[model samples]
Target: MDSEKELSGKTVLLMAIATGIIVANLNYIQPIEGLIADSFQVSKAAVGVVAMLTQLGYAFGLLFIVPLGDIFNRYHLIQIMLSLSILSLLLAFWAPSLIIFGVASLLVGITSVAPQIIIPYAAYLAPSLHRGKVLGNVLSGLLTGILLSRSVSGLLGSVLSWQYVYLIAAIACTILLGVLHLYLPRDPRQKQHMQYGKVMASLPKLLAKEKHLQGSAINGFCLFGVSNVLWSTLAFYLAHQYHFGSGVAGLLGLLGITGVLFASIIGQMVDKYSPRMTVGLGILFSTLSFVIFTSLGHLFIGLIVGIVLLDLGTQFGQVSNQAIVQSLSLQASSRNNSIFMFSYFLGGSLGTFFGTLAWSNFGWSGVCLVGTIFLVLALLGHLFLKEPEKLQKVS
Candidate 1:
């Protein structure tokens, strides 16, 4: 480990920007799903499969590819992944059939694991005392990319065609790939020469032995599921309820910046206080957001407030939970992060799937119910699960 080398602010910003740009590939199709449905002459519910498959592919990458970070040169691995990501984006841009597009989406998700790699690398480079704050700043960039991706895609899909969004994304990735090559430092840590099989096998053992990992993973699963439930069905709801288009749905994503603003602040709180406290606050804000959604979602202002709270709550829970998981072991940091992120994105996949199902069958009411159920499960895990003694004293 490069424990002695201090992480510079400029490098941290670079990593954050790299993560934001790379991760944006997985989200560009979300706001534009409705447009995609129209282009392919498919039902709104059927088009949702694209979103589900993308997240599932992300989960698959987290489990299989991210662990390689511990074994290989992460800088090389990231460059290779970003290179693959550009190919996938171009494939999506040129896809003629829905099936081909779905396949390209899956590939895009699989190759977009660079952000996960960068995150663990950042954690390793940062000082333990300020790790949470550093993570928060990086996460802010990531969250910003996620929010803006929807808006940009929505606007582009509104003006141009939906496929152009993917083309533009490909060009963006190509540019970022060059910038990272020029400025990003190579991994300074010595490589672990463990066989890939052994690295994969160790994941299950880590989950079984680490109570804190188990708790944090479950919290991540449910909390992220809650966030996806709302986001996955949001465009459909707007179209049905208010006669809105993909453009309006995309605009709503801008509201989530309100939550992104709090990411670093929440990270600082995790550093000074406890991950548990921030997690509880996250759950509280998420639960309240759902309450607003269920009761007052008919109003434009109500939806806006709910969106802000949902993002805020999700930011709090995600950053704090990650800090806890990353703190468990620096040597195993990549593997640890893979486990947490796998569960997290798995929840996202299922959430997108079920939220679409709920919207199809029971409308917005059903979507709210599904989100509530996820929150209830998250609360149970947060209140009942125990943290490690060392984690309780992060300061």
Candidate 2:
């Protein structure tokens, strides 16, 4: 495989599809928690544990597994991860107990870091001028999978057993693994010589040294936490307020396509302008979205409009932050991405925990209040944080 081979449109499209499929594994359980609870005769709070465990696993993978991309052949690494995903999905499909299913969910989450690898790989493949656009397109696939997986899961759960969802995903993963094995070129870069322990040691050093990386990680943490608060409890809110089931609740994701639509445009903006400027605009849009939801979430039309702004705003903020973070070091893009995502998903885990607690105690309003707090913190952090002129001295 020629590392110098220019990326084609077809290659980009394949990366996008592969990313979507891999990411969907992390989210396919979200909308169908009710179904799983019913099957296991458990409380909704207990079902929330499933999602929490999955997120925890993802964070762990980001910290531990993604750094390997900087050292090993990424193509082989992806194949290994996809194969693990298939095994985990099979376990999820056939688990005899909720405990078994929960464990499988964790494994699925761990292996689902394939997209994290793919995103940076795409960045490497693309020319520097088009890097933002390429990353945005790939991330659009990622976000679409995160949002739409809910709908697909809900529909599958409605039409068949919830277990069937995992079963089907296993089959899909198998096919994707084959496609990737055939289509992906061998990674051409020489493997890094850093020992694994040294690699792990550098994460904290990087965070302490790179002020921009620190700020972006914190921003990612808060914004993702806010987003998770909404997604984690959306189904329960709809079910309680509107007498809707998982299927109807899941349909809200379709409205969230506003994010997908704006991703490439946001990428172009990143290329033409500063990431900081785009991030500021995104924060304003997201903050306005919360204002709408807080005041008018009870109204169905209001929910739709709020979701559109919320999705668009979050994607704008997220993509720009990524563009900046990925620029820190070309050689360490994978490691840099890992640190950022580890923080990002760590926030997600916290949000899921508290979001479920909020749902149990105070319901929709509580969820909104908590989510608002996260976003406000993110906005303030971005405003106050200063990027250092040269991180090389500290590094």
Candidate 3:
């Protein structure tokens, strides 16, 4: 493969598909937590610990595993991670105790960093002229997978069993692994001799030196925190308020596809306008979504509209912030991404933990309150912090 070759639409599409399949593993447990709770004879709130552990595991991988993309063969690394994901999923499928399942879930989160690897790899391959557009297309697929995973897990869990969701995910990953082996391009520019310790050490230096990275990381943290606040507890909310099952909670995830549909357009907007503008809009949409969730949440239609706005806001913030992060240094793209996403998922983990805590204590009102606080923090950062001058020029 030519290191300087421009990415083809077909190759980008394949990467998008591969990203979607690999990333879906992280989310399969959300809607089905209730089913797993029933099987393990645990409270619904207790099962949330498993969800939090998974997000923390993903944060750990972002810090430790994803930087290997800068040093090793990304193509081979992706395959190895996918294979490990299959094993982790299988472990989740067969575990008889909640403790073992929680361990497997953590492993699942750790190995599922392939999408993060793929994103930076795609950025390296894409022309700078079209990088935002390309990333948007790929993210559309990624978000689609995330939204669909809950739906599929809920339906499968309701019809069969929660354990079967992992079994099926394992099978899906096995197939995706073969597909990637056949189709994914190898990066010829990888540094075979880069020291792991140095790569890891540069992370803090990057965080300290890059003003845009710092601002974007904080935005990503708070924005994703808002997202998880809703997702981590959505199943319980549906069950409590409407007497719905996991199936309906999963099906409601479909509503968020409205935002997914606009991902590419948002990417184009990033290319045309500025990341700062899009990010601000994202924060506004997210804030509005919570307002709806807080006030009109008693109505099912309110949930539908709030979901659409929330997802749209998330796409705006995530894609724009990622574009800024990737543009920082092509040589250190993976490490840059690792720094940004580590904070991103760390916030998600905390959001899941605090969101569940709020739900346990104050019900839906508490969940909305938690999400609103995160959004408000994100909004304040966006308003007060100016993008680095270099980042403005790059955009």
| TM-scores for all predictions | 0.97, 0.95, 0.97
Give me the runs in candidate 2 sitting further than 4 Å from their true place: 1-4, 386-395
**Model 1 poorest 10 in a row by lDDT:** 386-395
TM-score of 2: 0.95
What is candidate 3's local distance difference test score? 0.89
Tell me the tens digit of each residue's lDDT in model 2 across 67-179.
99888899999999999989999999998888999999899989899998988888777777777888889889888887878888877887899999999999998999999
Q: How much lDDT does candidate 2 score?
A: 0.84
Residue pair clashes in candidate 1 = none
- Per-residue accuracy of model 1 over 219-298 as CA lDDT, tens digit each: 88988898888888888888888988889988998998977888889889888877888888889999999999999999
lDDT of 3 by residue, 1-395 (tens): 44336578888899888888878888888898888888999987788989998899999999999999999999999999899999999999999999999999999999999999999999888878778888899888889888999899989988997899999999998988998999888776836788999999999999999888988899999999999999999999999999899999899888878878898999888888788889988999999999999999999999999999999999998889888888888888999999999999999998998998899999999999999899888987887775532233232
**What range of 10 consecutive residues in model 3 has the weakest lDDT sum?**
386-395
lDDT of each: 0.89, 0.84, 0.89
Q: Which parts of model 1 have CA positions greater than 4 angstroms off?
A: 1-6, 388-395
